[model samples]
Target: MKIMVLSSYAPTLFLFREDMMNAMLENGHQVIAAAPEPEEEWESKFKKRNIKYVSIKGIERTGANPIKDIKGFFSILKAIKREKPDKIIAYQAKTIAYGCIAAKILNVNEIYALMGGLGSIIRNKNKKSLARNILKAEYKIAFKSCNKVFFQNKDDCNEAVGTGLIKNEKIVMINGSGVNLEKFTKKQIPAKPVFLFIGRILKDKGVIEYIKAAETVKERYPEARIQILGSFDTNPTAIKEEYIYKYVNEGLIEYLGSTNDVRPYLEKCQVFVLPSYHEGTSKSMLEAMATGRPIITTDAPGCREPVINEGNGFLVPVSNVEKLAEKMIWMIEHQDKVEEMGRESLKICREKYDVKKVNDVILKTMDLKKVRKNQNVI
Candidate 1:
């Protein structure tokens, strides 16, 4: 059988779904990965894994643009026509929405999708926009043909049902993409307290709050190291590069830019923080937890999943600078308890967010076992 994986970002396939796809390959399936142009040596990276890379252009990953959407839809349509895959798995907004429709047009019934998050526009709970309405309409049209729709959190699933995109029968909830326990082993906590935040430098990610809190926290506890690790994004809620530079230049924050591997940074920090507006499931947080670092995150959907208030770490209100700083200060004051909480974090990660455990659930749902049985019987 031929299985095609659709992704808006190239790294997502390797970073998130590599285990599942590799499992499929081992089960006697040809795996073809489709996405926009990659950043570095991803084409070679995929080739190294024996996965075919298909580059489809005109995919605007962050925002909604009609010209780009139309072009992306056709590009996917052409790719689907040419590859003629037996099954397709697509994630992210553009890839799921357009890829599903393209597969349907070609009469492919084995279409599956993962809603990582509803997208940045829908993250705002207060305001409603025309873009949200358009997305709802597109989701409604495309989801009718999906065999199963995997979601990282229940809130995202409920939101989809509320929008009438698909019925309850189609929903499958799993932990975020999950973390590689072997890759992110727990290291010794740093001597002095250090707080780390790793994510795209976007306003919706609570970066502004992190900066403000970092400034305040620095004045109170100057020894506490605050660092931000991520690249500037093109999302509408993305902050200008100058803002990040302003804080970094002023010595309020340490900007580490981006890296293919985050384990070293995860090892350096005593605590991890992400005040995101929302998430499908936060892979970065899970990685930190696997590295035996306690968490401080927002109470919103995906952000709130792994935390047990006052247990592993604290959960601050979204966009609350004061509360965010309070938790950071608490961690600094009580260094002895920090390691205990980190142990709990590592425990939780192993129980629930281990990559192998999560991939087993996905493989079972995808009917890999049943397929293998059929093949053997023949």
Candidate 2:
């Protein structure tokens, strides 16, 4: 069987979906990864794993441009025609919308859409209803023939169903792109207190709230460190470079920029924080849990899924800088409990969020194993 996985970002295919892709290949299935403006490094990475990489043109990850999106739709349709895949799995908004439509037109046997998150348009409170309505209609059309739609959290699934974008029968809620426990092993808690945030520096991700919380916490515990790891995004809600530079210049937090491997940063942090407004499932939070770091995230949607309310870590109210700061201070004061919480985090990750187990569930759900004659049971 041939499988085609589509994503807006090339690195995401290798970063988050590597385990799934590898499982498909080990099962004697061919995998072709498609993305727009693919990085050269990702092409080499895919080649090393024996997965074919193809570039899809005119995909802008941020906005909605009809002309560009139409071109992108045709490009994906052409790719589907060329690959003749037995199954098509697409992640994120644009890719899922366009990929599913293309696969349907090509008469692909199975189409899977992975809703990583509702994009900024749907989440943006400031946006007009017209745009959201239009997007919902597009989703409904794209998912009309979808075999199954995977969601990272129940909130997203419920919202899609509520909006009539997809039927209840088509939804499958899985742990947010499960973390590789082997790769992100538990590490000893660092001596110095450190809080880490990883993701695109977007406003909706609660970057402003994080900064405010950091400021409040730092005034009390000057010795404690607040660090951010991620690159600037093209999203309209992205945090400006100047704003980040101001924080760095003021010595409020350390900006480590972006890196391929976040394990090193995760290892050094005592707590992982993401005060996001919403998420399908936060991959960074899962990785932090796997790395034995206590989590400090918002009580909203996907952000709250991994947390067990003072179990693995504390969950503060969304956009509540005071509560966020309070939790950080509490963690600092009771340093001994950090290790215990981190251990629980690692335990939960091993049991519920292991990549291999998650991938197995996905493969079984898609019935991919039965479709391949030489499938390897990895």
Candidate 3:
């Protein structure tokens, strides 16, 4: 069987869904990955894994130009017509919408979409209602033929149902893109208390709030270290380079620019922090958990799923710098309990967010399991 996985961002397929691709391959299915133009390195990586990578044009990560979106829709339609895959699986908002529409047009059966997050349309306060309404309408149209819509969190699923984009029966909630435990094995907590935040440096991610909390934490505990690791994003809410540099110059944060691998940074920190306003299920938080690091995140949709207050990590109110500071300070002061919390994080990862388990759920739900079984591939 042929299975095509579509995403707006190319790297996301490798970074977050490689296990799923590999699973399909192991099950004797041909896998094709469709996304925006990929980096040469990523292209080589996918080739090494025997997965074909097809570039789709005009799928911008930040903007909403209708003409460009229409062009992207046609690009996907063209790919579907050429490849004629047996199943279509798409993730991210734009890809899911366009891919599903293309699949439906091509008369493809077994169409699936993974709603990673509702994206900025739902969270950006500055967005016009008209734009939101248009997006909602597009989602309704795109998902009309989806055999399954996988949501990373229950909150996102509920919101989709509430908006009438999809019914409750069509929804399948999975733990965020699961962590590879073998790759992100537990590490010893750093001796000097380090708090790390990883994600695109966007306002909605609460980057500013994290910086403020870091400033407050540093004043009380001069020995504590605060680190920020992520790229400056092109999103409208992205933190400006100047602001990041100012914080770095003031010694408030140790700014490590974008990295291809986060395990090294994860190894050096005792706690992971993502005070994001929302999320689909934060892959970073799950990675931190697999590495046995306690987390500090906001109590919002995607951000709150991986944490159990006072268990694996603490959950502060969204955009509350003061509370975020308090939690960071408390984590530092109560160093003795940090290891215990870290253990709990690893336990949760094992029980709920292992990559194999998540992929199994995905494959079975897509009915690929039955196909593989009939082929005697599993």
Candidate 4:
């Protein structure tokens, strides 16, 4: 089968979907990846495995320009025509909205849409906005041709059902883009307390709340290190570098700029935190869990899925700086418990969030061939 995986961001090809695509190739499917402004490195990373990369110049990762999006839809349609894929899996907000429509036009078999997160468009409080309404309608249209819509969390699935975006029968749930356990292997918890947040600097990611919580925690335990690793984003609610830098300058939190690999940071941190307002399921949180780091995230939607509330870690209320700080302080005070919780985190990850396990569910749900263990062609 010729499987085409569409994405708005190229890096996600490596970060989020690498295992799934590799599994498809191992099953003897020809893999084609399409993204906006694809990096040259993509070819070197995938071409040898017979996974082709296609550039869809019309797609933009952020903002709403009808003219541009319309062009993007057409480009996707053209790409579908050219690739003539046997199966199509589209992810990210814009890509799913456009790619599904294109797949439908070409009568592609086994069309799948991954809603990694409801994202700002669906989660935004301002539902009356023209852009939001338009996207909602586009989503309804996209659902028509989608054989299945994979959601990372139950909350997102419920939200879609409530909003009539798609019928409940079409919905499927999977762990947040599964973690590569082998790549993100368990590490010993650092003796020194280091709490880390890994994600885009966006208000939706609760970065501001994380910052505020850091301020509160650090004032009490001045020795505790609060670090953030991620890059600036183009989201409307993105935190300005200046604002994050202000805290960095104040020595409250150490801002380690973005990195292609996060294993080093995950190894260094004893606990991972993400107070995101919502998520389809947070990939960063899962990666940390896979690396044996206890989690400290919100009780909201996807953010809450991985937590067991004192099992692997604590789940504070969303945007609650006080509670978030309280958990941070608790982790700092009970370093012994941190190691125990970290072990639980790794156990849970190995059981439920391993890339192979999660991908097997996806492939079985899509009726695609599932690659057995030790058969990864990548």
lDDT of each: 0.85, 0.87, 0.87, 0.87
Question: Which clashing pairs does model 1 show?
Answer: none
User: Any idea what lDDT model 2 has?
Assistant: 0.87
Q: Residues 1-378, candidate 3, lDDT per residue (tens digit)?
A: 889999988877877888888888877788888887754546667877888888888888676799999999999999899989899999887888888989998999789988889877865445457777777877898788799888998788888888688888888888888989888999999879899999999999999999999989999998888999999888868889999999899898999998879999999998999999999999999999999999999999998888999998899999999999999999988999899999999999999999999999899998776344323221
Model 2, 165-203: lDDT tens per residue? Answer: 889998887887898877989899998999999999999
Q: Output the TM-score of candidate 3.
A: 0.95
Poorest 10 consecutive residues by lDDT, candidate 3 = 369-378
TM-score of each: 0.95, 0.96, 0.95, 0.96
What's model 3's overall lDDT? Answer: 0.87
Tens-place lDDT per residue, model 1, 39-80, is 355677887777878887888788577998899899999989
Q: Rank the candidates by lDDT, best first.
A: 3, 2, 4, 1
Q: Model 2 off-target regions past 4 Å?
A: 38-41, 125-127, 370-378
